[model samples]
Structure formats: C-alpha cells, structure tokens
Target: MDKFLKMTGFATSIISWYNINKRDLPWRQNASPYHVWISEIILQQTQVKQGLDYYNRFISLFPDVVSLANASQQDVLLAWQGLGYYSRARNLHAAAHQIVERYNGVMPDTYAELINLSGIGPYTAAAIASIAFGEPHAVVDGNVFRLLARCFSVELPIDTGEGKRFFTNLANELLDSTNPGDFNQAMMELGALVCTPANPDCAICPLRTMCNSYRLGNPFSFPVKSRKTTKRDRYFYYFVHESDKQLAITRREKGDIWQGLWELLLIESDKRLSENQIVRQLSESLNMAPLAVSHVVEMRHLLTHQNIFASLHKVKMPEKFNLVTFKDKIVVYTGRENLTDYPLPKLIEKLLAQYFDLPPKVL
Candidate 1:
C-alpha cells in the first residue's frame, strides 16, 4: 500500500475503534477548552482512574480560569493534596493567573498561545489545541510514543531530543487533519487499551496487521529509552512535639521537596540517625530535654528522583515548657484537632493515620 493510503487506513481504524470503545469520561462529556486544559494537566503523571476524583473536585472548586486565579496558592495546594508532584499544581495556579490577565480569563485557542502558558508544554498544548480548538496538532504522550514506536519499529530512544522530534513529525504526518480531535484521542486510547507496554492485546489491535514490531514478534522492545533514573535516598526524622493539647507544625520552606506543605518538626540528616543521636539533636535544638522520647514508626516514601526514609517520633515536652521558645523553628502551634485544616505531604499524612490515629480526609 502507498504510505498515504496506509496512514489513512491507520487513522480510520483508530477513530472507528475509539468511537465505540472509548471510555465514557467526564472530560469527554464537555471538551471545552478550560475542561480539557484542567484534565490534561491533572493527567500528566496521573492515571485516568486516579485523576478522576481530583478532576471533579478541582473543577467544582475552581470551575474557570478566573476562579482559579483568584484563589490562594495554599487553597490550590490544599485541593491538590495527595496528588504528588506538587509543582504541577503550582504551575496550574500560575497559568490561571496568566490566562486571566492576558487572555481575559479565556483559555488560549492556538497551540502557540497555549504553550506559552506556565507548565503547558508541547504535549499538553497539542492536546488542548486539537481536542478543544479543532487545531491540527498531534499530541505525543507516553501512550502515543509507544504506539508509534512499535507500529513503525523505530529504534530511536524516546528519551532523546532527536527521538522526540522524529515521533512528533511522524504523528503529525499520520494525523487526520479533518478530525484531529478524535484522531489524537483515538491514538492515545489505542495505546492505553490495546498497544500497552506489556502483554499487548495484538489480536484486537487496529494496526496489528501493519505493525512492524508485531510482525517481528518483539512489540515490547520498540519504545526504547536510553536513560535510567537513579533515585537518591535521604533520611527524615520527624519529631511530633505536643504541649498542652497543641501540636507543633512547620511549613516546609522553599527550595526543598514538599514545599508549602505542613509537617511535624523535622530534623533531616544525610544518614539515618540512632535514637540517642535523635534525642541529642532534639535537646540541643529545643534547648530542653524531652520528657519522654518514644519511637513511633518508620516509612519509606518514593518520589520520581528521591527515596525518603522517614522516621516519626513522639517527643513529650515538659509540663511547663513553653512552645513559644521555639517560635523560630516551629511555624505554627495548632490544636491537635485542627491539623486537618493545613495541607500535609503524603508521608506526614500517612504517619498521622498509622501512628497518630488521625485519619486523612477524603479529598
């Protein structure tokens, strides 16, 4: 078959399959520019099933660009709690302000204008442009990359700049210009459902007959990556200090993980500290020995590039000890019952639930 004819067949097969097999999602119910933009941002490092509730809650809270822009950053982060990679939430808030100021509270229609917004990169820009605005821009996310790499048997590493360009051009060439919205969604849906990373359902794949990797019987090996991520481990010692029914908490400072989130008094160390070492550090920092030092529990928290080994401890202060003495170190002294009002990192939240008997609220 001629290349053009084959491409047309590929697109037609995908769109037809999508029309019948596509999951009924809230975002698909209304492909408005604002809805698509929010869904795309939420789904970047999140699965559809997990992101569904967050999307519903976020839309309910903010509803539109103006509402998001007017809200405080803390409120946005609070709404986005438990969804890791907090930078995405921060960027979304920033972009909302940008949209309100520059575009008069309307999402930009063109790919160029959309991409210029904070955190709206090529894939997101293409998604919003094509799906929401009917622009002929192909989105190349993880799903699309896997589908194209295997179908064409491309060996270029998907992590490299050159490989990304090659796939972007190929996707655009194969894009159905007349129906770019469904075409892009069809490609993504096919990859997500059929042409998966492992154990692909090739028998029902729309492009199985023409897939080069399928013919070679090595479908899993086509989407190549040249780089491997190495996660660095750090130890965190979180001291839960309580005095007169008030708990000491601090907001994580800028230039660190979990920035803008609240946590117990923290003593981070390059290496894990012994119990004695923890006591000594705490005594020195607070200028008073803890009345009782009880080891609570340890948990390992994983991030994209970091592995945190966190230890939670309870440090009972003396009866007459004043929390005001450590005002510089402790940002807030809130009643034990009011900790839920402050947004906390997942690690801290888990610690509270497992050891402190404070249940996390359903977001």
Candidate 2:
C-alpha cells in the first residue's frame, strides 16, 4: 500500500473506533477551551480514573478562567491537595491569571499563543488547539508516543530529542485534519484503553492490522527510553509541637518539593539520623528544649525522583512559651481543628488522619 493510503486507513479506523467506543467523560461532554485546558493539566501526571473527582471539584470551584484567576493561590492549592506534583497546580493558577490579563479572560485559540501561557507545553497546547479550537495540531503525549512507536516499530529512544521530533512529525502526518478533535482523542483513548504499557489488548486495537510491533510479537519493546531515573533517599523529621490545642505548622519554601503547601515543623536530613541526633538538632534549631518528645509515626513517601522516609514526632512545649519567639521565621501556630483549611502535603495529610485523629478528606 502507498504510505499515504495506509496512513489514511489507520486514521479512519482509529476515528471510527473512537466514535463507537470512546468513554463518556465529563470533559468530553463539553470541550470548552477552559474545560479541555483544566482536564489536560490535571491529567498530566495522573490517570483518568484518579483525576475525575479532582476535575469535577476543580471545575465546580473555579468554573472558568476568570474565576480561577481571581481565586487565591492557597485556595487553588487546597483544591489540588491530593493530586501531587503541586507545581502543576501552581502553574495552572499562574496560567489562569495570564489568560485573564493577556487575553481578557479568553483562552487563546492558536497553538502558538496557547504554548506561551504558563504550564501549557507543546502537548497540552496541541491538545487544546485541536480538541477545543478545531485546529490541526497533533498532540504527542505518552499515549500517542506509544501508539506511534508500536504501530511503526520505531526503536529510537523516546527520551532523546531526535526521537521526539520524529514521532511528533509522524503523528502530524497521520492526523485526520478534517476531524482533528475526535482523531486526537481517539489516538489517546486507543492507547489508554487498548495499547497500554503492560499487556496491550492488540486483539481489539483498530491499528493491530498495521502494527509492526504486533507482527513482531514485541508490542512492549517499541516505545524505548534511553534514560533511567535515579531516586534519592531523603529523611524528614516533623516535630508536631502542640500547646493549648494549637499545632505548629509552616509553609514549605520555594526551592523544595511541596512548595506553597503547609506542613508541620520539619527537619530534613540527607541520611536517616538516630533519635539522639534528631533531638539535638531539634534543640539547636528551636533554641529551647522540648518538655517531652515521643515518636508518633513513620511513613515512606515516594516522588518521581525522591524517596522520603518521614518520621512524625510529638513535642510538648512549655505552657507559657511563644511560638512566635522561635528563630525559625516560617513557624506559625494554628488551631488543631483548622489544619484542614490549609493545603497540606499528602504525607502530612495522611499523618494527620492516622495519628492526629483528623477526619480523612474524601476528595
């Protein structure tokens, strides 16, 4: 078959399969520019099933760009609590403000303009442009990458710049320009539901007839990556100082993980430390001795590039002491009941639920 004819058949099969088999999602119900943008951002590092509730809540809270722009960053972060990779939330908030300011509360329709907005990368911009604005841009997310790599049996490392460009161009060539929105969604849906990373269901795939990887019986081997991630181990000691039903908390600074989120007073170390070492460091940092100290809980939190071994300890302060007098400028005292009002890291949230008797958040 001629290359163009073969590609047309592939796209037609994908679009037909999608129209018949696509999942009925809330975002698909109304592919407004705002809805698509929000859904895409939320789904960046998250699965569809996990992001659904977050999306509903987020849309309910800030239904449009103007509302999102007007809301406080803390409120946005609070709504985004459980969905980690907090930078995405922050960037979404930033982009909302940008859209409001630059475009007068209107989402830019062009791919070039959308890409310039905060947190809107090539894939996201393409998604919005094609899905929301009827542009011919092809989205090349992990799903599309895997689909194209397997269909053509491309072995280039996806982590490399060369591999990215090749796959991107191929996706553009294969895109059905007349129906870019459904076509893009179809490509992604097929990858998510059928061409999964582990044990793809080639039997139901529309492209299986032309999939080189299926013919070679190595569907899992085509989407190759050159780089291996090395995760660093970190130890976090959280001292929950309570006095008169108040708990000490602090906002994480800009240069670290969970930035802009609130947490208990923390002492971070590169390596795990003994109890005596923890106590000595706490004393030195706080500039006073705790009346009593006891371990509460220990949890292992995993991030993309880091493994955090967090230990929570209860520290009893003197009855007359003032938290404001502490040398650590970030420390602040809040009512124990009000901890839920502030956005907290998942580890801290779990600690509160398990050890502090706080009700677990449903969303």
Highest-lDDT candidate: 2
* Per-residue accuracy of model 2 over 1-363 as CA lDDT, tens digit each: 246345668889999999999999999999999999999999999999999999999999999999999999999999999999999999999999999899999999999999999999999999999999999999999999999988887888888999999888888888899999998999999999999999799998988888888888998787999989999999999888876777888888788899999988888899999999999898988788887889999999999999999999988878856676333556778886687789999999888777756566731
Give each model's clash number.
0, 0
**In model 2, which regions exceed 4 Å deviation?**
1-6, 325-327
Stretches > 4 Å off in candidate 1: 1-6, 324-330
How would you encode candidate 1's per-residue C-alpha lDDT over 287-335 as one tens digit per residue?
8788889989899999989989999998887685656544265557888
Q: Model 1 TM-score?
A: 0.95
In order, candidate lDDTs are: 0.88, 0.89
Q: Clashing residue pairs, candidate 2?
A: none
